[model samples]
Target: MKNTILLLTLLFSVNAFADHSTSKFVWSGKCLNSNCTRSEIEAENKANYQKHLQHIQDLDAEQEEEDREWSRQHDEDQARADALPKYQYKPIPETDNCVTRFYEKASSIIGDNAKEYIDVEEIKSGKCIFGFKLMAEEMCEYFDSFSSMATPDWSEAEWCRYRSELREVYIQYSGLVGTSAFTDAVQAERKAKLKPVEDKHHKIYQNLYEQHLKQLKQ
Candidate 1:
């Protein structure tokens, strides 16, 4: 009877040990010290907290430096804008028959037989239409006689006169692009925006050029 009880106790102990050994282990990034003191843990947490604080401080300093740089750039950009001319569109010349003359000249370049799509190519060849940049450039120069006039070193009235002429030509381009269709959407957008963009750039350039002439005089 004693031997049977001892054998049962040994079997139960073995089973319990096997079950404990077979259980899965879970990792929790904890220091593998079951006997660690509370003071030791507190020391480690304090060190980690200090490192985190330092990292946050570093990030704040970096962000502050970036803000300073942007501010400097903003100031510089404002100065540059102030230096250039503030171009606003002028009304077309009110001379009698001015619009009539504009269309007449444009028609000669555009040809007598006009359509919704001005075969911009002037010369028709197969299905592809290449545009008439030369004619447009001539008209641009013609309309603004002061564009390349005397090295663009003109007085305020002269610049205003030039803008009036350019404005009229620009109006014609606006009408043409709006009314007519282009071979492609890209070409259409280009035609629409070209004159306006050029007008703005030329206005800025003219101001700088006038300043240059002043420097030469001084």
Candidate 2:
């Protein structure tokens, strides 16, 4: 009877222990359960919210950095563009037969003395002796007129021809005047006056040549 009573007591004790173990919750290390206190869960949730806010802040910072980098690059590019040489080229002027006008004026200035200075056979043979001036007075007058006139908006070819004629006239004039102190002084003064105008024309020609080359390449 005592053995049966002890057995009953043991069975009852086992059932009570099982019930107590199951009734009270225990942490499983996975998710929050009834075992978790409100304070613990709230703290965990606050930590997660902070992590989320931090992640968003990090993304915003990264985007801002990228935008700043892009802006910096754009500014650098613009600076380089501004630093490059910029040419303001004038529009090419129409052909006005300036070469013919230049020759006609020289011819008119030489009029009666044309036979003395010009070789008619040279003209017939297509040789360019039209620029020669045998008289100092005629040469002076022609040069003065040529220099005082404003630079024509002529084509490259016209400028080249005009310069050639001026050179021819100066050569003949120098030979006719010979090398006296007065003539030397006069020549020097004329050369000095002509230099700047010649330089401008030469620069224009260079620009035109470069522009044509670029067009050909295209």
TM-score of each: 0.29, 0.28
> Candidate 1, overall lDDT?
0.47
* Sequence-dependent TM-score of model 2: 0.28
Off by over 4 Å in 2: 1-36, 92-218
Spell out the clash pairs found in candidate 1. Answer: none
On TM-score, the leading prediction is 1
Off by over 4 Å in 1: 1-35, 93-218
Tens-place lDDT digits, model 2, residues 1-218: 34345544664454323324434222222223445564654565455445645666666678789889999999999999999999889998644454444445556775744434332222222333233333433343444454332232224243545466567657755654655644767777777767876777778778877886887699
Q: What TM value does model 1 have?
A: 0.29
lDDT scores in order: 0.47, 0.52
